[model samples]
Target: MRTRTNGIQLLRNGERSVDKQYRGQRIFERLGNVSQAEAEDWLKQRQAAVDAQHANQLREGDEQLFAAAAAKYLTECQQRGVRTLETISYHVQILLPYIGGMRLRDVCNDSLEAFKDARVTEDGVKNITVNRSLEVVRTVLNRAARVWRTNGKPWLSTSPLIEMLDEKGQERPPRPISWGEQAGLISRLPAHLQRMVLYTVNTGARDDNVCGLRWDWEVPVPELQRSVFVIPSEHYKGKRPHVQVLNDVAWSVVQECRGMHDDYVFVYRRERVKNVEDEPVMPYDRIDTMNNTGYQAARKAAGLVGVRIHDLRHTFGQRLREAGVPEEDRALLLGHAIEGMPQHYATSTIARLVDLANSVTQTRDRTTLLRVING
Candidate 1:
């Protein structure tokens, strides 16, 4: 008589044997009086070894697809918590339609020419946008050739020299809104958005910084009788701690929004009412960005068709220059990276910056700029 399991059988001679085909490979082995559970464990180990060997054999440069490499690259980026990972992923998706099926060995500058043409002529995107996508492709190929490897063999033999299109005159100049234009734009926006836009113009902060500003980042200074916000590197564009000194206007905006939200400085008031009989429950939610539909609609209503959210920042910089603020102080106030300057500000330096920032608040300090509208 013989006792049989799924893949193992005990023979009359008190020995066990496994006869099974796994992944098209025959697993045949005999053991001396081993239990069925023990035999199953041996089978599992054999399968894992076979899988590893197959993976190594399939990881050849010519066999691996750019799609696979792109997937791996995205995984690595996500794992590293890359700040611009979302944008990188968007670029990868755009490139995939053209290069996804190509073998890693076949990806090169010549193969990407059609993609560039389609993006420029058909998609009507600027050379800079296309260049950004090409940069992602270059990054993925470089990583495959240098970092990613299997069985001591690189995923790619070498990365090709990917050249970017000439963007010399294709770039759009920054549009700094006039005080009159700012008034028109701000007046057209919703109350909450008006405050956020005003804050950005006053502080020269980017859209992300203004929207992501937190209350906890505010540091009190008894010496100056005011507080300044210090943004962490992770939240800032420069990848360094940035100190934001609020001017009188920005501070007043802060005061208007004080105690509205426990965490965020700028937020949208969302009113909820289930029934007419009940009172409206107003909840303040964090604003993701100042460049939302409200800002766009307001700009449209104000007839500032060429204005962008970033123009608010330029407006502040331009006003500071017109107010006779020095270049170094302007750089510091605008949160531009200055060499040899500490990220943390001294109270005295903060006081001076506050004064300089307050100078732009005067209506008389203005420059007549000829705004060039781009087609």
Candidate 2:
């Protein structure tokens, strides 16, 4: 005989049993010799309990475990193709012990404070480090409230407020590279790295933009009698299109990189592993994302410990100012949206941008630049 128990079902199969959902989990219960009416009554009571739990009148019968929620969050991130999935997963593993079993409702200010203290006092973690972990946690919870849902109920009524610790003391001042330091640093780098650095400094492009640049994005501008890179709105920051006119020096680097790789404009030689297969292969067009750790040894050898690859962009912006390029023209050539202007500009604006780009193409002693790499 088949028996009903709320949304669950109970039937005779050599024993009396019921199947039901409890706290978002499927459970099988065996009630030996119990009547079908009894199982139905039990299920009704459980449903009432769940209602109370959701009403905040009880803490039992309904719980969202942190570990389970984290799994759901990671799945969403994977679907979105977040590049930091592996890194975030590693951090989640580290955080499991602190919050794996806690109910979602129990994640209050005190609980977060305790987690922070444990990380700082016992694990000796820095505040900034703790903040990054908190960022991942915050992101997961925010999605649960704002986007995640099941059966018309959001995983959370609202996302918890995550306050970031003040990092005033840890904030490093910006370092704009001088031409001489650029000369020295580039000389010590490998041929591929040298070109990447040179291209970045000249074009004012971020490391990711430089690395992710593809040949298909380049468009021939017959009006300007040359080609320019036009990064799509999605790829550029602020979701706006970025147009870059290749200066004389930067264009030379691109020409040399032609045919080196099938798609990417920049590629580095990856050394083979010792005795591991025939070759220790590395991915092409890859940027050392950990703040350029691979280039540290070369940077130190050049006696520039404080310099960073990002400073190359700053160098470009500064050089533009030094050369008396107007702010509006500089911003245009450097691929930033012109604020306070109509979305559409006159056709002559392209010529204006090209003129400003050529103005900065004037480098100090092209011979010195060529000699630095022994080219």
Candidate 3:
């Protein structure tokens, strides 16, 4: 008598799985949730892989690679235009060696916690860094469970819950850049960077926006006789072209930045493409701007230590409040979602916005280190 068994069967939860003989050994493979038709299609693919292997055209370990799943997840993220995929990919690379060879079902909380602990203890990495790495692992697992399917069953039985480290002990937020400190910092910067800092202080545009700005986005407000720049959705955070209202100081900075570079609004001299200099070398490319290292050196030289570039944005917001600019209008000027824009924002036209923007603009002499605040 021959042994009888239902080799490929559907589980109670509607998942199709296979426990069949392959190469004289019992092979068990689970396919994620898929319809009967899709499951059959997957079976064909599996047989094809085996066929290619027997013909010596396929290498071993093709079906058992975890990194392949992560690569597929990254491809999906790129297809959906996920802006943060670069950060995710960076963290994923850190996790590749830890569990890259484990079978999908073998990844449990115990192994994951071990990986996390090793990252903290052995590598001397911070808990937050470990958490970020674990997050990428969890994301790839979740994508495998809910997105990728083999023969109508999920790669992993389920996605284990991944916890994050508590941020109880973290560095304090960057302090707001004070006027005299700002002035001192700007003075220490090279000529082109000085103008860029002035523009950032006036308009509150982010570093990337200011650095990547192009001349083509300028919209001339002929009725008001001033030009404003519109940063497109892909470049800005809000998924809309940020309307940069140009005030007196900001307009002056813009005028100075113009005619120096044909495309990019801001350009600086590139000495070795990474140093401070005095020339028309900075284009709309990576070579154009002085990076964080140069900025830090300039800050230390100005006696304004412990200042980060992002603090400039805080400085702008603080100055707006000090200048008595309305909160609603300030939101508009800062490229934030205005509270009552649909109701009264259209009436609060570009001219009105320019006035508010100018109110926060520091005077020419204020840029001098006349009254430096201790804090």
Report the number of the highest-lDDT candidate. Answer: 1
Clashing pairs in 1: none
Q: Comparing candidate 1 with candidate 3, which one achieves the higher TM-score?
A: 1
Q: What is the lDDT of residue 282 in candidate 1?
A: 65
lDDT (CA) per prediction:
0.86, 0.71, 0.71
For every candidate structure, what is the RMSD over all alpha carbons to the true structure, in angstroms? 9.3, 10.1, 13.6
> Over the full model, what C-alpha lDDT does candidate 3 score relative to the true structure?
0.71
Clashes of 1: 0
Question: What lDDT is obtained when candidate 2 is compared to the true structure?
Answer: 0.71
* Candidate 2 Cα errors over 4 Å, as ranges: 1-62, 83-94, 114-132, 271-285, 288-290, 336-351, 361-375
The local lDDT score (0 to 100) that residue 326 gets in candidate 3 is 83
Instruction: State the weakest 10-residue window (summed lDDT) of model 3.
Output: 362-371
- Name the candidate, 1 or 3, with the larger lDDT value: 1
Which residue pairs in candidate 2 collide? none
For residues 1-375, write the lDDT of model 2, one tens digit per residue: 555444445454545666777777455667666666777776777667776555443322226777777887888778977656777897788778878777776665556787788888999977888888788888877777887776678778887788876667666555666677788888988788888888988888887788877898888767666677877766677567777667777888888888777777877766665865664455565554424655687789888787677777767876777667888777766666767633333446666655665566564533333335532
Better-scoring candidate (TM-score), 1 or 2: 1
Worst 10 residues of 1 by lDDT: 365-374
- Candidate 1 at residue 176, lDDT? 83
